[model samples]
Structure formats: C-alpha cells, structure tokens
Target: MSITWYIHRLRAMGPAEIAHRFVEKGKKLAARGRMEGWSRYRTSGPLPVLPGLADNLASAPDRVKQDIVAAGRDVLSGRYSALGADWPLRDPSKPFPPTIWRLDPVTGGLWPGSEAYCFDISYRHERTLGDIKYVWEYNRLQFLQPLAADAALTGNPDAIEAIEAAIDSWYEVNPPFRGICWNSGIELGLRAISLLIVTSLCGSRLSDATVEKIRTILHAHQVWMARYPSRFSSANNHLVAEVAGEFLISLAMPELPLSGRLQAKGRRILTEEANKQILADGVGAEQSPTYGAFTAEFLLLCCFAARAAGQPLAKGIKERLALFSTFIAWLSDAKGRTPGICDDDEGRVITLSRHEPAYAASVSAAIAGYLGTPAKGPRPPEIELRDALLQAPAGGPAPPTGLRTFAEGGYTAVRETRNGRDLHIVVDHAPLGYLSIAAHGHADALSVIVTVDGKPLFVDPGTYLYHSGGEWRDWFRSTRAHNTLTLAGVDQSTMSGAFNWSHKAVASLDGIEDGENWRLVASHDGYRNRFGCLHRRTVASTLHGFSIHDALTGNPDQTTEIVFQLSPACEVEINGQEIRIRSEKRWLATLSFSHPGQIESAAGGPAGTGGWYSPRFGIKLPAPRIVWKGALPPEGLLTNVHLVPE
Candidate 1:
C-alpha cells in the first residue's frame, strides 16, 4: 500500500480508529526496532509440546493414516497444490522442497527481506508482488501436517527428513518479523496452527536442532499476535483466527507463566467474536457463507485443543455452533456442496484434504460429529478422519434437513421433489455484510441461486481475485456476475477497494408466501440513489422450475439487463426468446423470456469477462452466461426457468 492510499484509507476511518492507528504505529516502530536486532535469528531453545496433541495424533484411525501417508509422500515428491490450483513450488532439478518459500508461483514474484518493516511491504499490489495470497498460502506450512503425520504413523525416514528440511529452510530464510510471513495477523495465526499440529504429530521424531528452531519460531509468533491485533473494520475473521491461534498455543503450553494470559485473552476474544461475527440465525455477518464456515472451523479447532487439554470454552459458543451447523445443513446441496454466496478464498484452518471443492460440508459434518448432532448423511471419509483426530464422538443425532426461513440472516429457501427432480432455490435478501467496510460482501442483493438434483444451474459465481487492481476483481464481485438484474451497467454497491464498499445497497424482504407455488419477494435500493429506482424481484417455484420477475417499481421505463450465470456443466442453445441448457447430452432446463429483448450468450473470457465461474479461489473456469437486455415493464420483466424431465 502506498502512503497516498494509506492517507486516503485513514481519511475514511473515524477519530477513534485514527487514534488507534497512530498508537499502533508507534508501538510497531518500537517493536520493529527491537526485532530488527541480532536476536531475531536466534534458534537455540527447548520448547515443550502441547498437551493431548501427541495422544490425538497417535489415536488417529488407520484410514486417516493411509491417506495422510500418501499425501505426505506426494508433498515430499514435489507435487504441491493449494487453493484448488496446482503450484510449481519447487525447482525440480534441486533437492526436495528447496527454499522457494518467498516465491509467488502465480506471478513468479520473489519478496525480499532484510529487516523489512511489516507495514512497509507492498504486498497488496498484484502487479509488483504477484498475488501475495499465493505466497502466504504456501508459507502457512499447512502441507507439513501430513508429512509429520506420515512420519508419526509409519516412522517414514523420508517424511521426517523432508519435514526437518522444510522447517530448517523456513527458519533460515524467514526469521521472526524479518519477512512478509510476519506481517498479517491471520497469516501468523494460520501458520501457528500448522506448526502446532506438526509438533503434535511428530515432535518426538524431529531432530533436536529443528525442535529448538521451532521453539524460537513459536515464541516469536505468540509475541507478535499478543502485541498487534486486528481491530475495527478488519476485526472480522482475522481477529478470531489470531486469538484462536494464541489460545490453542496457550492451551498446549500451560507450563509457561505468560501462557495463561494469552490463553485467557484468546478465549475471551474468541467467545465475544463468535457472537459478534455470527448472526443469531447462524449466518456469518460478513454475508459470505464461506467466511461463516471459516470462523466456525477456527472455533472448532480451538475447542478441539481445549478439549484435549480438558478445558472447554464458555457456554455461548455451543449455541452459535448449533446455529451455524443448522445453516450449513440447509444451504448444502445433495452432494454436500453449499451455495458460494459471496467471497471465498477457500481458507481452511487445517488442510487435511484438498479434493473437496469447498469446506462447508466438511465443516458441517465435523461440527455434527463433535457436537453429537445427528448427521444428515453418511459422514465423508475426510470428515471421519478429522473427527478421529479431534476425538469427536462417532455417531449422534441426525441433523435436521428441510427448507425454512432465516429471518435474521435475511434468507429463505424452497426445496421440492416433484416430477422426478429435486429442486432447491435460495433467495438472498441479506445485508451487504457486517462492519463499515462490508469487506468480503458482494454487490449481489436479491440474487437467487437454483440447483436441480444437486447441480447448480443459476449460480452465484464465486470470488476469483482479491487485492488486485484488475477488472477481474470487480467482475467477480459485480452484480453482473450473479443471477439477478443489473441496471445502468453498474454494480449494486460501489467499490472503494477490493474489500471495501464505498456505497452499500440496503435490501429488505417484502414478503414470502407458499400455497400452490412457493414465492419469495425481495427488493433492494442499490440503484435508487443514482437512478431513483428500486429493483424488486419475485421468485416463484413451479413444478417445472422457477419464475423470476424483476420489477423496477419506482420507475417502470428504466432499462436493465437480467443476468443468469450458468454453472460450468451447462451448455447453452439459444433460439428466439427461449434458451435451452444441456448438461453434456442431457437437456437440463429451458429459460423463456416474456419481454421482447435482445439476447446474447457469452462464454470464456480472457480475464474474468462474462461467462466464467470460480469454484475455488485462484481458479476460474469457462461457463456460459445468459444476458437479456430490455426495458423494465410496469408488470416487471418475467423469465421462467422450466425444468427438463429426464
């Protein structure tokens, strides 16, 4: 971030925030001066392992051991993949997993470190830094868990040797607070979790020298997290992750005198944040379902650590966990995939398996297993493995499964099983996320996602990029990228930056009724300020499919383009006002428009243009998009989606 941009962002903050920034700046300078000295690279010390971590690792089922062994071997063999994209993390010609820690494989940008201040790094600028996320993802060292677990399970010499090399290389290169890894609290938090898990899994086998280095690394991580905490607008998931990291470490290392202080602080902050970040109805306040799951995962991991230590969090968390799990069950499809409502970076506290496209189902199952909530279906194998590691009960209550309304979360759904088809539709009338910045929230209000027989048809394209000054970032979060009506060729909410919202659109639930056909009525004022028009959508579920009516009530003569973003599985055939979608050779659905308008179909853009969908972070695939350009009539622009019976 430039000084000019810093000043501009500061101008947006309030007096209290500005004051806090100055105080933190001074504190950072003092800490920077101390950490920059010769003591930073120190690597000689004795660190005690966390309580219960060793036992839990030992008790992992044989099933988990088998998968982990393979993954560990793959990681050692230099087949590194992250965030649903394969990474060229190592120089294959050199020895295994070389010092490529600072390399951003995406753009091939190498970050430098010679006593650099954390705030001085220009990591957010993609043109220069090459997507800091790619760098940070690898550096999180999440891949090490399986490697160490492999060593623990099979006493694999190669696994232990590879683990030692990775740790030693990390210690040699990225000394505490001297590199980009030490900058963000969330990065520090996630990295701390990975380190703790590895230590638990293979602390006994690690070389004494490597163990000493880890001891030094963990102490530095604790100090950094304790000193600098994310606050105000940035305090959403980042705060929870940081505190949870501190809490888990503290729970493990109770021998240290300061460990209790960190433990109490982490526990308190996490408890408070669980309530603040999650709505009463279980939806994450960020308006992103994935973020909700991320927070839930963070909490669950902490709870696991606490349980291992025979200390549990306060009662407030259980209530929220139940609600969060319920929300997941409702949103999840037949295949266990949930709606990609807003921004999702595919962030996970633990990277046990990368094959699952997203972690909501995994999280849902894990939560159910831990809480003894009745699971809806057979637990996923990965979920079973995680439960075994966390020591959750094997079987419990069958989780509730049905469509209902979440009034507080501003959502309603319709589930139908008729005509030999299973259809589910979710109507989003939710806020533009939480906090002043509304970070991670998309400009997609009154958007509807449709799934038939557990397959996405009308989809909400997942977020592909963040902190990039490219058009793709805007496109992924734009109104045009959703299944909704886009008016005036602009987003529903204005963007200040990648994560910041300059102007927000307020959405409300007009009404919801069910008789012969299930209907949802919602409206948003995103364009009312500029165009003096409100976009109200009526979504009715029919036996065949769905009917969407986009009404510009305040002004009927306004022009708008109705967009229905298709899943990557869809192939389109457009003819007149009726458009057909096929999944390979099987006809899926047909969309018929009532308004006389120009029809255009788009697929495969060079860089985040129309007709693209992101299933995971850092990955976008070509998908067809249906665009209808016409005037909003007084009765509203009607489009019906008729399901094609097999």
Candidate 2:
C-alpha cells in the first residue's frame, strides 16, 4: 500500500525488460495496423461509415488491402503511433519507469489504487492502460488476447511472432502475468482473456498443442470466475462480462464441471442486472450519453454471446438492452454526439467507424442481426436501429410521466408538464457502480436542480477533470457545487479527505403522485450518521412558480442554516413577495427564511465560490442570514425557495 512497497517491488522488477516487451508489442500492433488496416478500421473516413455491411465481405480481402495501404500512408506520413521499439522504460523524462508501477494523482497510486480511480479505469477508461488494473481484464487484456490466439490458431508464423511479442510486452507492465493493483482485475481479466482464446480457437480445428493450451486457459479462467462471484454481483460492465464469459466458456467446453452451473447463474444474473441497470425510462445512471451506449453494447454483446452458445437468455434482455441503447439515440444530437454529461463525450469505440456514429450504429447492427428486421419507427435516423430493435419507451402511447427513473444514469428527472410549459427537476439518485461520486456527487444529499421555463436557475457544475489536482476534484464533489441546503455553514459533508467511492447513499424516490400538480418526496442517508440527519426534499408546482422545502431532522437543540444556491446571474426575490438586492453586473439575490422567531438576517460578505481550479463564478450573498422565529417544528425545518424570472 505504501510507495516504498511499490519501490521495493520495482527494484526486483526489470524496467528495461518490461519496456522491451511492451515496445515490441506496440510495434507489432502498429505493424499489423499498417499491414491489415481493416482490423483497426484505420482507412475509414470521418463520415458516413458504411464498411461493416455483409456486401463488403465479398471484397473483404481487397478492403483489408486498401485499409493497410491507407494506414501505410499514415505511417509513412508520420501520423501513427509514435512508440516504435523504445517507450515508457527508455523515456527517462517520464515520471515512473516502465516496469515500476507508480500512481500519478492524475491517474492513481500504485498498489491499491483508490476505488474511484479503479472504477473509472475499469468502466470509463477501460481502453487505456492505467494504475487501475481491474479494467485490464474486461477492457484491454480480454479483447487483445484473442487477436494473439487467432494468429496462433491460423498457424500464421508472423501472427505467432507478434502474439509472443505482445504477450511478452503485456507482462512487462503487468508483472506475474496478472494485474498489479486490485485482485478483482486479475479475476476478471483472466476470464475475458481465456474466453477470447476459447472462441478464437473454437472456430478452427487447431493442432493438439494449441487446443490443449486453449482448454487449460479456459479452465483457469473458470477457476478465477468461481473465486470472484462479487465481480458479477453488481449491475455494471464487470457483471455483464462475467455472465457472457462464463456462458461462452461453458458452451464451448461442455466437459468442464462448473460450466453448466455457471451458465445457469450467469444467465440469471444477466437478466436481473439488465433490468436493474436499464432504467424504467431506459438510460444509464451515469447521466452520460456515451456511457449509456457503452453499457448497452456490453449487454448486447453478452446477449448475442449467450444466444449463440445455445444458452437461453431471457426474452426481455435483448429488448431492454435495445431500449437503453435507443435512449442514447434519443439524447444524441444531429451529429451523433450525445451531450457530454459524464466522463468522456467521445463514447467508447467498439470498431473502426469513421466517426463514433453516436454509438447508435452498434445497437442498430445488433438489433438488425437479432430481430431479423431493419430499424425504423419514431427514433432518430442516426440511432434508428433495424425494425426489430425499435421498441418505444414504457407507457408507449401515453406521454412519459413525471419523476421517471433513469437507472442507468443514477438520477431521477421530475418534469412538470402542464398546459404547454415544460419544467424539469433532476436529482442525482444514481447507484454507486463504477462511477466515483466523490467528485461528481454533491454533498447536497437531497440537492435538486430546477429548470423553470427550460432555463437553468439552479445547477450542478457538472465535472471539471479527475486529474487537475485534489482541490479541483474536491470542489467538484463539495456541496457548494450543487443546488441544495447546507446546514450550519458546513459545506455538506467534510471533503478534506481522499475520494471514497464506497461512501455512497442512495436517494430513493419513495412517493410520487399527481395532485392538481406534481409532488416528489425523495430521501438519502448521506447525512444520517454525522447528524442523524435525513433530508426530505419536496417540490410542488404552484400558481406562478414552484414551492420547495427541505425538512432536516436529527435530535437535541442545534442551530441549522439553509441556503438556496442560485446562479450568480440570477435576479433574486425573497419570499412570496419580491424584494430585490442592489446589483446589476454584480450578483443579486433575496435571502429570507422563517425559522421560528430565531430567524435573523445579515449583510452580504464574501460568500463567493472558492476552489482554485474550478471557478464558481458569480455574485454570492457575502454574509446572508435569515432569522428563524422560534424552535424548529416537528415537520422539520421548512425553507420556502423559488427562482425569479429573468
């Protein structure tokens, strides 16, 4: 866990040897991409991606040639990967030597990377090599190993040479032929890699030695899978990979003892997890359009793998999977880019598409192949998958209801649909899967963002960057970043420590009903232990605007203060009546709250947004305080807040 442990391990590890291995592997891949460009889709231009059609298969060889030729041009033009034979080890200017596993705060520490760092690498940054080893299994190592095995299966000496070189290189950065960080990575990676090997070799009647090696690897992966059931227990990508991998290996190798039972359990997990992960409305909880697509693709891949192996995947899994992918289509703009809500806006790359086709292409293709129909109906053209995959969101004919759950994105969006007006309120009730709420999660447990008249009066600052130093990440995770009530001037929960992914509390939608308007009551335990606190936030549409209240309750006598965070540009009006603060270009807001008779008011001090990296710009009520008249009521503390018209 200590830097010294890593350093000592590094001393025993050979950086030069590791560097040589990785460099050689990179060279082989770069060479392959140059030799067979179709494998990496290097030649596809940045628009109208039409390369993966069945018609193209007739001229597959020629296409591959053209691809390689195009890639060769990039190489000759000096526009490809620049690693060559010397990389991290020989690059003395880099922070850590190639073999020595060290964590960059921008990345993570060596041995046991933070859970936040680990989950991001696995689910978000899976394609990239990083301190988080959990990703290696499901993302990189699993997919890469098959290419190496395919070369060996073909009896292609060139590919075998490349495979050997690649494996050697992989081991240098990843010593002991396993991951360096979490044990979960090793368990997951080995399963994926072995499954890849099994599928790659199963298509060919290979030599005895090759077949035996494949079986051994497959068995080893099963052993790892049995030991790591927790990996599949969650509703994330790792669970998907586990189920699919188990099913694939089991069907491919029927004689294995655990294969049948694992397949059964895997199928169950897949079905249940799919339901849980795909929201009632069909969007990933990460609130990321790209992650939504990525998650759907993983589900579809698993579904297909299960079906192909004769495993009876549940009937609704495919439909549910397609629905989630379709949600991605719904959110994408004309250009195919889903709004960058979370992590990477680019989405995850599955194949060599020219542009990231809004990730709708992958789903479209899967639906086309599975449903035996082409995409059509009411969805966007970019995401309109073949007919079979097109299923409308729940409550089809009826317009969607308010406060619908977006399980995939881990938030609840409650909208007010009255007459022709559209008002929206999104609360982060997302599950703690791979995403680290540490920075993205606001301490405002029952914090809410309201968009009245479709304008953001209150908001969560989204995210800045995970690597821009601790202060930046901390501020992004602080209570000040969100629209919520902070008590006693304490900025939500204390944020001085390192980011903790495990420190999660779900904000569940307990009751939602239709009155003359809409009412929402949601709660979370984020503040329970510290203050025996439970924040119950209620929003109801009123005559003009909406009425907001937060009932914070605990024990004993304590003085609690609540602030309704507004955009610095907002023109503030306090109470049911409008009383303006004096300012124009400067920030203005009315501050008032009835806390019994004890409620007091003060002048504006320096209540501006702090945090050096992330600038919370705008006018702040320097020293604003509203007096509470008397003792708090049993209904808890009620603060009526509303936004003023621009």
Candidate 3:
C-alpha cells in the first residue's frame, strides 16, 4: 500500500478495467450513486414473507437455542462478543452496545466521522483509522442476528427493543454516503444480510416504524450495489456477496419497488458469477480455502433464501453448490478444521456457531441438506440450527477416504488410511489466484501440506495480516514461507501489494496417479524469468511418508532452498542431513535431503522470518521452519520423509 505499489497495480489493470476506474472516479467526483443517488422509491407487494422462515428456528435443537439465547442476553447487557474474524476491534468495556458507531474500539480512534464522504476517506493513508475491516465488522451489525433469534426463540421483548434502538442509532451516526462505514459494497451486502436475518426472525415483534425503516435502508443499499458494483479485477467474492445481499433484500423486502428488478438481476449475475468464479471441480478461483468457504456460503445461503422465497434456482446452480461444499469437506481435517491456504480474514456470511469447527459443520450440513445427501463427516453440536436456518435436506457424502485429484483446480488431496495411520496431505500446484491481480493468492506454487492422523505436521503458515502489515505481510506471503523450493532466493510469484501479485507463476499439474501409494507431478515457471529454470517436483506417497523428487528442467546451475514449514504442535531436532518432526508423545516423521550441503532450523529469530503460525486472523505464534540450502547435481535432488511411530 504505497504510491509505487499503487502505480504498479494500476499498470497491471487491463484497458477495460482502467476505463471502468475512470468512470468510477468520475462518479466519485460528481458525488453520484452509492447511498446518495436518490430518495426511497415507491413501495410495492406484500412485505416479503421470506424472512418469516426464520420462525423455523423454534425447531432447532435446545443446545443451539440455549447458546444463542445466552449470547443474546450478553448483547442485551451492552457487550457484543458474537464476533467473527474482527474480534480485536471491540472494546472490553461496559455500556458497549451504545458505543459510537464510528469508534475504532481497539485504538480508541474516531474514524473519519459523519462529515466525511465515504469516497474521500483514505483508510490506507490514515493509520489512526485502523484496519477498515475492523470498523466494517462492528458496523455490520451481524451480532444482532442472535438478539433477533432470541426474540423469536422466546417472547423476549428486550432483544427486540435492543435491535430497534441499535438500528436507529446506527443510521443516525452513519448517514447515507457519509463516513467509512458506507465505503465498501461488500459491507453493505453483509449488513443487508444481517438486517434481513434480524427483521425476519423478530417479525411482528419489531415495531412497524422499525420494519419500514429497514426496508428503506435495504433499498438504498441495493441502489448503491446496482449502480457501483465490484467490476473487472475487483469482481471476486465481493461481487458474490454483493449480489447475494441484493437477492436477500429482494426476497425479504418485496415492498421496495426495485425488488422485482433486483431479484432478477441478482439471480442472473449470481448464476453467471458462480460459473465464472468457481472452478468446475468446486474450488473458488481465489485460491484461498477460507475465502472459498466465505464465497460458497454466500452463494449457498442465497440459494436457500431464494428457495425460502418460493423461487428455486436452476438445477445446475445447486449442482455447482454441491461441489463447493465438497471441496470444503475434503480440505477439512478430522476435527472439522480446514487449514488456511492463502488469506483468511475469517469472513463468515453469518455466525450461528462461533467455533470454527462448528462453523464448518454447519456449512457442511447446509450443503448436505440442499442435496439430500449424507454429510461429509461427523458433525459437532449446533448443526440443527444451521439446518433450520437453511431449510435444506440434511445429507452429503463423507470426505474422500482415498487420493482425490482436482486437476482443473490444481489441487490433490491424499486422505486415506495407510499402515494404520490416517494420513491427509493437501498439495498446491495452482497458479497465483483467480484473475489479473490474483488478489488473495500467495507466492506458494507447488507447496505441500501434511497431517498424519489429524495432527498438522508440514503446514501452510496462515495469513497473519493484511492492509496494515508492512514487511510482515510480504514475508508471510513469500515462497520462503511455504513448503516448496526457492531458486536464487526468490518467490514463485511477484507481489506489489498485500492483495496484488504483479508477475504470476504459471503452475502445471502433470498428473496425479497411484503406483507406490499416490504420486503428484507438477512444475512452475515462477523463477524461470530470473533463473531460466522450471521448478519441477514429484511427490510420491509412501506407507510411512513421502519420496519427493525435485529438478530444474530448463537450467541446472542455480542454488535452491527447500523449506518445510512445521506446525506449532511439532518439535524439530536435526543432526547432519536428517531432521525429526514430532508432536507431544513422539516423532511423527523423519525428514532428510538428497546431497544436502547446508541445512538449518529457524525459530524465534531476530528477523522473525521463519517459525511462525497464525491459528486465526490477527494472531501469529512461533513455529519451526526447516530450510535446506544446496545446489542439485545436473541430474536431480531427492527428499525422503519416513514416518515415525508414537
């Protein structure tokens, strides 16, 4: 996020995107659209009954019901802890619910207040404003869903009163088109979903004045989204979320005159974008599984919302949605935890279950119910509430119990039982990311991840920061941060900003086959520009562990650094050419290199480059990383990883 980085980013855009930016800039100058375009239009139709579907929550399990009610009671006490990814942004003080909408609760800084047009606000330039996501999360008002759910769960008039007051307060503080809260389209979409959830669940419990006020607010949001969309390179998950918001608004607030128009528009664009943004194999084009889950949930929930409105999507739409959850099912471990591949803001479309594993289960349940298939795996508590929320039929096939290849998406999962060990390995040969900027992708082409019997060993160091991170962002996103080969000490892809990758590495997956166990053959030309070589790797699975063969096909003289990032659960010790990686009781695997010249284990260094793991967003802890440095012979270099018994 520097001037130079901005220049490179602009230069990276295509002519069409450049033209769109100019058009958007002109709109900004004119102060047109985006919550300021026009007054509330005329009303029409019976106010949507779609939101009434939330009444079904009465059928949800008592455990989930009690948890939601308890969370709601906490909110009633002026504390909102039903937070997702952006938890650090909230103040731990009392009388918190009435806290200023524009306050950055973490830094205690007042964000550019109601006087500033959202267009002119420079969140990146103003460190005092804090991360924009933090403000957006607090302002999203999603925490109110449980309040509304509580009201519906029982005849709790207090929850209803709190929600009405909060809405009235939010509108008064952050007016239309003014302040940082109105800055992004995705924020509007997210808040829209939250609003509908509240209104639908609370139903007649909310005052008529409040219901009409929500209808007006939702209409303004759709007007902004329709006028100024996330177009061109920006059309990733943001677009999906925006359209989903509009679709829900149309379903929940049919009184808005534009409801019919937006419903049609939302469905068309969602269907089109679903095919465009999601691979045929069901992986999100963004290359980040966390973001993938976020996107899939948006589309999936929107699909359900449409159904609840008595408007089902095409058969193909549900088919593609099935694939989405299937990929998520495969990526997740035995504990329902899925490792982050690229960036993870911990973006949740809605937070019924605060726990990540439970969140995964709920999404899995929704997908299963929609398809009327058996669930991918055993689920934790709270699935009943999610099933109630989606109104989907419950079932999906279990996560694969054997090697599975997603050739089109460039991912291979080896999830199976071998030699009495439940081994799970996720290999990445995917290109940087989805489109031109490859926004969420890291320079981690041809990297590898391994979990033996559900314990992480070789892991992808999760995304620790975005936007505010400086050198830390670059370091965590580099080739050096992943379990892959680096030639001449350079990343596989070039990054200009936290979200922008300038030069991208083209990764090709040669094959995924079974011979001696399962093997994956892949290569990337990331270093070919500088070193004139293609980094080719062949990962062959073993009964015990891995037989990895690496080679430089185009050029052979460059020195290579093969890094293996270990899980924080692991303890590493090395002697000579071999390294032993272990957890609590015993070593999980023994690792060694072919013709190693120099090797070292890095942890808690002064530079802070290695030995770091981010369990969640905004948190990073020290973990060991093994770096192997040497030149391979003209022939090749081979690595052997043999499993150790407990």
Candidate 4:
C-alpha cells in the first residue's frame, strides 16, 4: 500500500474505527492462540420484536409470497444466479467447506485452499489466481433469502431445518471479528438486513435455538458496525447501507436491551447521512448512477421499515427520497439505461427482482411505487414487490417532463423530440468526486453520454474492476475511457492512489441556452496545474443533430486527443472524416469533425489498452472508440453528430 492510501485511510476513518481495528486485531491474535489477552462484547437478554411486525409480514401481497417461494425453490434446486454466473449451491445441510472460498467464479481459477480463517489470508495479494471479487460474492450470503422464503412459504420443517443447519455451519467456521466476510462494514450491514428479511419471511418456522443464533449474529454485526462506521470521506454509499442495516435490525427486532439506543442512533445517522450523501439535486455524492440507485434503494428500505413500524420519516427525508427518484427518471434513457458514470459492482440492497442490475427501469418503477408518483415508463415486477411491501398506491400526479439541469450535481439533460424520435443527451461537468478521497469518482470531467430513440450511441465505458492494480483499473477511470478530450496524455485529475485523486480538476458550468436549440458550455481546470491549459467544451443540440466543440484557454498549441467511446452494441464504419455509427443492424448516427486529424479505433489487444466496455462487473466486451488526435489551434476543434432514423 502507498503512503497516500494510508493517509487517506487515516483521514477517512474516525477514532472509533481506529480503536475498532486495534480491538479486532487483538481478537484475531487471540483466535490464532498467539495472544492471551482479548475480550468479547456480549449482548444481554433475548431479542425484541416490535408491535405489528408479524402483521406487516403477513400483509405481503399473495403474488410476492408466490415469487419468494418460487425463488427459494430455484435456490434449493442448485440454480441460483448472481453476477452473471449460474452456480449450484452446495448441499445446505452439510458444513460449508473452506475450499469454496478459493474458487473464482469469473475466471474459473482457484487459489490454493487454506484452512486458516479468511481474515488472515491476503486475498488481494494472491494475484496469480486473478480477481478475488467472486470470493466476496460467495460470502455475501445472497442465497439466504430464497432459503428463508421457501421455509416460510412452504411451512416445510425440512426447509427450516436446512436453513438452520447452514447458519450453524457458517457460524462454526467463521468466528466474530475474523475472515474476509468481516472485512467490510457494508457487507456486515447487508448480511444483517438479509438475516432480518429471512427472519421476517420464515416467522414461526424457525426454531428457538435457530432464532437465538441469528440474534447472536445480528448483535455481533451491530457491535461491529457501531465500532467501525464508514465515516469521513469514505462515507459514501457504504455508510448509507451500514446505517440502514442498523436501522432495520433495531426496527424489526426491538426486544433486545440495546434496541432503543441502536434504533435512535441508526435513525439519526441515516437522517443526517441521507442529507449529506445525496446532493441537493438528488444525485448521490459518489456520482455513479448505479451507486446512486443503490443508495436510493437503501434509503427506501429505511423509509418503508420505519413507516411499517409506525415511525414515519420526517417530511424532508421523504421529499429527498422523491427527489432521488426524480433524478433517476431524468437521467435514464427511454429504455431506462443509466449512464454508468463511476464504479459499479452490480451491488444491490436486496434482490427483489431477477432482472439484471443494469436495468435502471426496474429501479425507477420501485421508486415510483414507493413515492406514489406515476412511473415515467413501463413498470417491472420489482415495482409490484415494493408496492406490496409498502402497501403504497399505484398512481399520483405525474412528474415534470422535458430538459432539466442540476447545477449542484453538475449534470444537464437535453430531452427533445426530433422527427418523432426521442433524443437524450447527458453532460457531466462535476468535480472529480465528493470529498478528500473521491473514492468512487472518475476523471471524465466533461464527458457526454447520448442516446437516440432509446439506442445508445456515444457512451461511458463502465468501471470494470477495482483493486486489480494494473492497466485495467487505471484505464477504466481515465479520461480517455470516457467521451471527452485529453490534453498532453494526462488525467484531468491527479491520481494519488487507486481511489484518491489529488490536485483535482474543478469543473464549472459556464452557461446554458435553451430556445430554438439547447446549448451548454462547461470548462475544467484539470490541465491548468500541469500544462497551463484549460479545457472548455460546448455542447449544442438542434432539431436534427448535435455538435460538440472542444477548446483550450491557456495554451492553444497543446496537442489534445478527443475521444468518443461508442456503446458495445454500436458498429462504426469510418470514411474519410465522416464516421457512420450503427446499432442493432441499423444506422444510428453520422459523426463529422472539422479538424484534419487522424482517427483511430481501439479494441482490446494483448496490451488491454483499447476500446472495451464493461456493462456489468467482471464482464468486458469489445467496443468501438473513435479517437481524434491533433494539435489544438486557436479556433479549437468541433465534432458534429447527425442523428439518423431507420
């Protein structure tokens, strides 16, 4: 690890987190029998349940019950799917073997199995086997939902028995404060929420002993989260998830002695963090659309849980939730695909729907259902699940439609109907990220993502991997990875570590013109510090097409490269200065540039530096990227995109 990473962690972590690490280290030492002094915190008394909790569970729509049961059956039959992998569940009745931890589902490579606890293993350092993301996927315990759901829905004693057996096996092998599963507070929070959901679904099917074990695990999770809350710059979506889990545990199980304190603390943290983490315009502070959606879902759960417990959220929080939904609605294309702006792990608060994580429409439907707003597009089954859980009504006043701008969030959307075809363009003119770390932000300051009649043309190459520590990680976050201009072959923001950006580029929206056509002008100072230059981009949309102009303020002689990354589905044919872009076997647009420059295409090669797109985590596909290289004259460079309808 670099000194920058250490300094980042030191600043981002709170005093409690520092203390918690010492305590956890001691416990790990004791577990290995290397230390004689260690202490374990214990919770007193039995777990509590709030009034009407059972009634709320019973009130789930009959359709939801059927879905849960069917999903559970799918899991039991060894057909559970996650992260684009279909893998069979090991027999739940047997103990979970240590070998399962070494298997990387994405690469089909397995590390040498180790009997030592996972916490002691440096999974990231074992680079020979490739990515270790799948290891965390396995530890997420996502399959627990289906098992608990099946146990509850069928009222089958064997199903409940198997569920308890799996829990027992996991507890036996993984102790508190140890293992990769315990490494992240967000993971622990997610597990606590999942356990609560299972408990809610299983109800009377669970044995007293099983319930006690579950409660014990929940108590441990609460303690861990309390000691190591994701705070400071590190507090992005992770903090929202952590506190939401704490809130769910406190709200769902109130009988425990610490429930009241936990409840109050959780609520307070959520309320304050929601306001802090969600920008005034409803964009998540992390600035990734996928993570923004994830954070919204987390908050929605808290909202629903609190309401169900007869403790409604404050009016401000409710309005903020609605704003979040509205922001997503505006950001989504006609097909409901959001621009993958930053890091996306395909993470979900809960898998209520079987739809792929990239399907932003499903998320919008759920949000619309919860807020009682008319959904902007087709509703998915996930929306029904949200309605069933919240008992919220179907329709309300429709949200405002048309072009919108969020100044604070530094995003502008241009939506119009040209030749009876819907056109949408999203422009980014935001900071590198939220705070000191900017952990999830990218270096694409003036990048643009465009869709015509619901088909993506110019797009953002989504984040493929993190912690890989190679060209792949750096390339995905680079300015060249986005639809923007790169000056002197340097990033708009300086990279301090994998997640930290120093000497950050600051972007500002100069002005917006909306009349016969929509126009936006923005500039960034990322190059000023190094090259004594400023990058200014002007985007204008007319009835038939759109144009982008790239200019430099300080140095007109600087050599710059302008890139437009095409969506994976797009096929490009270049003829002279005009490039034809096609998707789904039909021509989507024609691109023309004014400057006499060399155009090159990038597709992945042995070097792994080329045109590639990652629609989901751990999945990369070849894509066409049009790169224009030349010196910037005083007049600057201009590229015009003309939309074509089939």
Candidate ranking (lDDT, best to worst): 1, 3, 4, 2
Candidate 4 matches the true fold with a TM-score of: 0.89
Give stretches of model 3 more than 4 Å off: 32-52, 81-99, 353-361, 378-385, 391-398, 606-608
Question: What does the lDDT read for residue 283 in candidate 1?
Answer: 82
Best by TM-score, which number?
1
In model 2, the runs with Cα more than 4 Å from the true position are: 2-168, 171-183, 186-237, 248-265, 275-296, 308-311, 319-412, 416-422, 428-444, 451-457, 461-481, 489-511, 524-534, 553-646
Q: Write the per-residue lDDT of candidate 3 for residues 436-460, one digit (tens) a residue.
A: 8888888998899988888998899
**Full-model lDDT, candidate 4:** 0.72
Task: Compose the digit string of candidate 2's lDDT tens values, residues 1-646.
Answer: 3454333333332565445545644643443322221122112111111112212222234433334234323222212111011112222123223333333222333432222222222322222333232222122333333233333234444334333333334333432223333245234433443334423432243334333444554555565555444331133555555565665566556567776898778678878777765665676544444455555655665565555545557887777766664554443323333323433323232232112334543454444455544432123333221111222121111113354555435555555544344555666555433433232234555556654443444544434444222354555455544556555445545442322343555566666666556666776665676667776677666654466566766632444544343433344434433333323443222334444434333433322242111111111223222323344455765444433434
Write out the backbone clash pairs for model 3: 369-393, 369-394, 373-395, 373-396, 374-395, 374-396, 375-396, 611-623
Ranking by TM-score: 1, 3, 4, 2
- The Cα error of candidate 1 at residue 24, in Å, is 1.3
* Model 3 residue 631 lDDT score: 84
- Superior by TM-score: candidate 3 or candidate 4: 3
Candidate topping lDDT:
1
Residue 106 of model 3: what lDDT?
Answer: 53
Which lDDT tens digits does candidate 4 get at residues 560-609?
Answer: 88999888888889899899988899888888898889888777653335
- CA lDDT, every model vs. true structure: 0.77, 0.43, 0.75, 0.72
Write out the backbone clash pairs for model 4: 48-254, 48-255, 48-256, 119-179, 602-611
